[model samples]
Structures are given as structure tokens and as C-alpha cells.
Target: MKIYTLEELQEQDVKDVIQIEIDWSMAYYGKEEIYKLSQEISKCFNLDYLIINLKGNSIGNEYLGLLAQNITKCTKIYNLELILEWNSIWNQGIQKFGAQIQKLTNLINLSLDLRINSIRKEGALYLGQAISHFSKLQNLELFLGNNFVREGAVMLLLEIRKCQDIQRLALEFNLNSIDDNDLQQFGQNILNFKNLKEFSLDLKQNYELTSMAQSKLVNQIQKCQKLTCLKFCFENIDQDEEVYQQILNSLYKIKRLTFFQLSI
Candidate 1:
């Protein structure tokens, strides 16, 4: 993995760069600098994979929007990852970022680590809408743990239902305000991805999910015929041994699942 700073990237002309990891976690740049860097990346037409690490950065809406706007110019990028954990990104910034994300139709694998951000329902909704536009996406990993998510969970599930080609999905929503209804909806929506082979969910610290909801979700998951691997973590959920066994039994029905992991 080659690491590049924004200054170094601006001076060189990148060509046929299949993979890039930009570490901007410690660097602070103004909007003009961000825009210039974006233009430089946009010229790398052969870039197939990109990772932007902004962890611990104080980036807000303007920086995120500028980054997204410039990154979307690379129409051939197949895999994209963004590490924005602990940033100051809010709903307005997410909205602008989402708008640019919708233009990247060639993405096959997408990973986003936005945990501890200031995202709310509106920001989550915008992200959901943007994800629905990825017609070619197959693998997705999203980490939004500790954000202010409520209705956003439902919006995300609804939009996820539109991605018919998704094969592997991992979602983390720990410490959010999601409830039984949200899980129920999410469970039902899981059936939409007929091609899904691996599924992982982390709902630890989400106190609203109860035994009843867990049972319902397990029932829905059993309907996934193509799943080969499954991992579920519900560390803080209030549930008894019987309920946990019932969920395990439900997983037993998936004959295709070669690997199964559960934590309660």
C-alpha cells in the first residue's frame, strides 16, 4: 500500500494507480487546498481502488462535499473506502457527500467508517438514497456506531432493499437509538437480497432490541437461502438463554451456511 500526502500528490502525475491510501488524519487543509487535491485525483483515470483516511480530522460539510465532488470524477473506480471516524461531519455535509456518491455507478465494493460522527436521521437518509443508486455494488461494509440514528435505520433498510446484487453486507449500529420496529423492518428487507452470501450485524449497546425482535429477525434471516457465513453480535441486548438458543436453532435451518458466529 502506497501512502500519499495531499502535497506530494499535487506535484506528481499519477497513472495506472490501482490502489491509493491518502492519510489526512493529522493534516488540516482549507477548502481551496481540498479542491486542488480533488482535481489532481480526478486526472487519475486508471485508478481502480481508493482509500481516504480522515480519522481524527476536524473536517466539516464543506471539506467532505469538496472531496466527494472531486472523487466522483473518477468514473472507473471499482472499490472505494472512506475512513472518517471521529470527524465533525454533520447532516449537511453528508447530504453533499451523498449527492456526489450517487454519480459513482461503477463501484463494486464500498466501505465507510463514519462512527462517532454527528450524523442524524437526515444525514443517514441522504446516504441511503445515495446507496440506492449503486446498481453494481456487491460488497458493502458500513460502520455508523454511536451516531444519532433512529428513523435513519429504517431509511437505510428501505434503500438497501433496492440493491438486488449485494452479496456481502456488514453493518454496525452500536449505541444508536434503533428499536424493535426498525429491526423488524430490516429483517424483512434482508429477504430482498437473494444473492447475499455473507451477512454480519453488530447491534451491541442498542438497548431497544428485545428478545421478541431478535426472534423475528432470526426467522427472517433463516429465509436467506444463499448465505454461507453469518455473524451476529448483540452484547448488551436483554435476552435469556432460551431466546438465544432459539435464535441459534433458527440458524441451523440454513444448510448452506458453513460458518456461523453469535455473541450475546
Candidate 2:
């Protein structure tokens, strides 16, 4: 494991380093303090990826959102993985600090968690729209069961398809009102990604509807000659073993395949 103490981080001037991680598990030093920390870190590292963790419950999301805004100013930041829990305060924080989230155009990968039960669907749509503006974003992970708009998510995927730079996608859906047609359309959009290599779908409670959704999905996915890794989880397996074996055998022959997983 890689560990850096605050004192150690303060002393090392790794100006050419491409990755940095900051863990704020201590007390809430507020936005200015966090901004100072971000500036210091940015000065020391020419970063391509950054992992920021607000470890303790000492601060609300507003402070963290402010911190994120400052960090986006780092010119070398291209990938960001943020781990945060949603609270009403944090939701308010993002709403108050609107454009900062949308300004991160260099970002290609982002991971975040929102408290689904509390956030309005409109809030999720706004965030989705913000993400769509990322010209280079290829991978996104959001943790909120039913808080996001089904069409917005699909729209984001369609938008990313237009970017033609996206290669990996992961989506998590709670018990939302999405049917086979939605899946079919989403699958069709994914096939348009000529360079796409990996896809993952996490649907919590739609097993019985998946097999009905499977044939179209599998067919569309198979059209991607460049795809190598696939992660799928569905509720039903109405197809027989022999037929599945045939499909698997043909899929294994794809030129880019090195990893494959299908769960029913």
C-alpha cells in the first residue's frame, strides 16, 4: 500500500509526478485551508490523475465542493475519483457552486456517490448535463440508486458516443422505471462507439426482465469488434445452456477480448 503522511507530503516536491492522493480525515479546516492544500499539492505534482477523499464527517459537502472547484484548476488533472457521501448540505453546496463542476473539461473518469433518497431528480439531471459537457470523458461512475433520470443517463451515453473518445462505461441503477426498449436503445447507442472496449451495467432488481432484454443487448455488444472486456448482470436466463455456449464460443474469438463476464 502507498501511504503518505501530511508531513511527508509537505516535504516532497515531486513536481513531475503524474498522480497524487490527498486524504482529509482530520478536522474540517474549511475552504481556504483546503484551497491552500490543493494549491500546494498542485504546485508539487504535475498530475494526470487525482484521488481526493474527505475521510471524516467533520466538514459538510459545501466545503468539499469548494475544494473540488479549486482542484479542477490544476492543469494536469485528467482523471478524478471522488468518494463522498451525499447530505443535504452537500447538495446545497453543489447547487450554490454550479459552474465549477462543469468547468472540468479535461476530466475523462469520475466516480461519485450521491444520497439518492434525498436528492431531487432535477439535481441528478443537472449533474448529468454537466458531465455531458466534458469533451473527453470516457468513464463515469455515480452511486445513487433511483435519484438520476433514466433518459438523462441514456442521453449522457449518447452524448459521450458523439465524443468518440469514450471506451469504458459503468452505470448503476436502483429500482427505476426503465424497460427493455430503454435497454435496447442504450445498447444501440453503445454500438456506435467504435473505440469502446469495456461496458458494465449494475441494475439492482431487474433480473426477470433481463433475458427478455438480453438478445438485443448481446447482439449489439457483439458488433463492437474492439470490445475486449464486458461485465453484465441480468435477472433471467431463459436461454438454454447449449445456445449460450455457442454465443460464448463465438464471443471468445473476438480480436480484443481478454476479459469477459456474464451473470444471470
Candidate 3:
């Protein structure tokens, strides 16, 4: 069943749900309401697919942090999407949520949106290490934009190297404090995944942009032989189309990925 609000969720039985979407995005529920709603969701032990949207709630870690602590009972969920953008989740909160999520070892497709939060390097490392344990994960979407991940972005990429079965991957690292050296490190190991058919990398508005950095990154991306769909996002380019051609040329020369899009 698909419910859109807290009121709708209160009317249903959580125990029998296998696929549920409770999107309370942009809600203004206070602490009591949030707590009560999470308590009900924690009872969804049989849930296999869950999409809980509470973005822009401004309640910080109280949103996912509450659900993380209470929802660890669901040990067999295969697909989960936790959308909590603009919620101000910090280091401890992400670390805790990451630990709790690690318990769900059956996840195949997972989407985690923690955009515009205050996550730093240590938190990012812990979160990455936790996700790297998902040996069954095939598709992963991790959005950490507008934060201060810095070298933590590289650390996350390194940990994700363990998800060798991931076929479709989309990562948003925009406006994080990631530097040139970190990008190079991420690019170095980008081709280790052998099953990638689709990939999206968003790194817009990063600290600095240089020709050598972009070139090195694309060099590794071009080596992905099975990619039929590839997207790249970056900003502050002096010549947009020029950069696009340089990357596009590298891909077209591959003769396998005729279906590709480059977003500048």
C-alpha cells in the first residue's frame, strides 16, 4: 500500500505490509508526531520494500535517527529508500544510522538521501564502511551533496569498491569539500567494478577545477567496458562543450557505449 502522510499511515496495519511507500516529505510534524509515527513503522518487521520520505522536515537526526534505532527489527528487508534531505543530520547521527542499516544485510537496492547536512570525514568513513558490507547490493544511490565530506568522499568510494555486484550506481557528491587528490584516488579504482551497466557521478561546485583532474577522472571512467548509460555532472567549466567533447570522444572511441549522455 502507498500512503502519503502520517494520518494515512495511522489507519493501516504495519505488520502485513511487504511493499509500502509512506512519503511525508516536507511535513511539519513535531517531536511527538515524529516519535509516534516512527514507533509504528518500527513494527514493520515483515517489510521488504519501504520508501519513507521525510525530506525538508528540519527535525535533524530525530527523523532517521529515531527510525534507525527503532527499525533494526526488520532484518530481511531487500529494498529500502530513506529520503531525509535538509534534515541537518550530523556525525553521530549518520554513524548510528549506518550501524543500524548494516544489520539489514539483505538489501539489494538502497537509496539514501542526506543532502545539505553536516556530515564530515569521520562520519562519511563510518557510513561507507557500513555500506561496504552489503555483498548482495546491486543498485545503490547515495546523495551527500552540500556537505563537508572532503577526503571522506574518497574513503566512501574506496569502501564502495567492495560492492562489486552493483550494476546501476548514482552518487551525488556535489559541493562537498572533496579535492583534486581525492578525485584522482576515486578515479583510480573506478573500473574495478565489472558489472556496471549504468553509472552517474555528480560532483558539481566542488572546491577547485583543473584540466588535469577532469582528464584523469574521465580516463578511468572511459575504461568501463559494459557501461551503456553514463552521466557526469560538474560546474565552473571555462569551456563546457570543450570539456564535454573531450570526455565524449573518449567514450565514443570505445565503440560499445553508443548510448551515452554527458551533462555539463
Candidate 4:
């Protein structure tokens, strides 16, 4: 079997690379080398789609902030992934780097994966702020695994939804940290999303997704006209069967919705 590395990717004369996975190799290079190589690679490929997998040694917030600031020159970037764990040392770095990173204006699809923990709240906010600069963005998936609480996550959601161009959104809540009040606020924020075509959330795994929570969520979902696909996992309600049936019946008016999955 032939082992492929980033260096090997540099030699390839490909124009549009899709889902090229780079993992443990990041740890092999020093910061300077990593930075330089990333810059060279950005220049070499006329890439429209790029997927980065940071699966080994944790990528600090500072490193990601810097990479986001410098790599915006690529004209064809439509999809992006920057997944890193919560680094207490790097939390402050995200805000500082965020202002510089917002230069990526052409992105149409973006996926941000931030490890959930108390320390990541501010970093996730900074990351969301960075994404609002892309006016052309259509698909957005923000996975805030364990980083957000009610206030921080809600604020970020409200800000990101302001981008009228977005069509798809996925938000994951930290079940342990969020409660009823948080879900209510999140429900209120969802009302602001005007153009979404696909919406998904992992709300059932949390403490706040009760029958009332489901009612609030359903009420908000009814407001969006463009929504086509709905996927949500919520708490087991008292009337699970009847509620699910009612929810599906109400959504039938949406002409674009071809797939609907709701779980308790």
C-alpha cells in the first residue's frame, strides 16, 4: 500500500480536490513549517472544496485562528472544516484571530467543529463572528459539541442566522449544560432564520427538550417557508405518537420538504 502525505499532495497537479484527508501529519511539522507548507499548498491547488481532518494532537485555538486569517486568498473555497478541541490557553486567541479571519468572503459552505467545554464558549462566538463575513455562504454546519451554554450559544446562533444567504444549518447543544431557559431562547433565535432549506438539531439528548420545548420548536419551524428537510432528536414526550403525527401533518404544507425525520 502506498502511503500518501501532504507533501505528495503538493506534487499532484490536480485542480479540484474533494475530501482529501490529512490527519496525524500536522504534528510532524513545526509551527513555522506547518504555516509555510499550508500557504504553499493553498497556492498550488485551485481548490474549490477542501476538507481538513485534525484527528491527532490537538490543534490549538491560536493555530486555527492564524490559518483562517491567512488562507482566504483561494477563490473557489465552497466547503471548509476546522475541527479542534477547547484549549483554555487559546480561548483568548480566537477573538484576536477572528477579526483577521473574516476575510474569507467567497465561501458557500462551511462546517465548524468545536469541542464542547466551558472554555469553548467564547471561542465558538469568535468563530461564528468570523463566518458572518461571507455573504455568499449557503450551507453552514456548526457543531458545538460540548462548548456552549445557554447565553453564549444562543448569542452565536442569533448572529449567524443574520446571514440571509444561509440555506442549511446544524447545531448541536451540550445536553448537560443547557436547560429549559436555554432552549426557549434558542427557539426564539430560530425564528430569525429566514432562508433555511435544511434544518437539523440534536435537542432531544438535552434536559430542556420537553413537551413545551417541542411546542416552542414546532411553532418556530412553522415560520420558515423555504425549509425542506427537518431532522431533530428530542426528549420522549408524554404523547409521543400523537405529537409526532401532528408535527408531520403540520409540515405537509411545505412543498419543498421531501424528507422529514423526528425522533423522541
Work out the TM-score per prediction.
Answer: 0.94, 0.71, 0.92, 0.80
Which pairs of residues collide in candidate 4?
116-146, 116-147, 117-146, 117-147, 204-233, 204-234
Each prediction's whole-model lDDT (CA): 0.86, 0.63, 0.79, 0.64
> For candidate 2, which ten residues in a row score worst on lDDT?
85-94
lDDT of 1: 0.86
Per-model clash counts, in order, read 0, 1, 0, 6
Which has the greatest TM-score? Answer: 1
Off by over 4 Å in 3: 240-245
User: Which residue pairs collide, candidate 1?
Assistant: none
Better of 1 and 2 by TM-score: 1
User: Which pairs, if any, clash in model 2?
Assistant: 207-235
lDDT of 4 at 188: 66
Candidate 1 segments whose C-alpha is farther than 4 A from its true place: 26-33
Per-residue CA lDDT of model 3 for 1-264, tens digit only, reads: 667466665676867767778777887767577667777767777878878887887766645666776665777688989888888789888877887788888999999998988999987888889899899999999999998999898888888889899999999999996778888887766787788888888888885756557766887887888888877777754575676668767876555675665555
lDDT, candidate 1, 28-100, per-residue tens: 6655766677788888888889998877767788888888988988888999999988878899999999999
Give the candidates in order of TM-score, highest first: 1, 3, 4, 2
Q: Name the lDDT value of residue 196 in candidate 2.
A: 81
lDDT of 2 by residue, 1-264 (tens): 244445666687667657777666445545566666666665644677877665443345566566656666676678887655433333455454345667777888877655343444445555656676777878767665555345544655555566567788776665554567567787788777777888777655643345546655676677788887887766455667764765576576567888877776
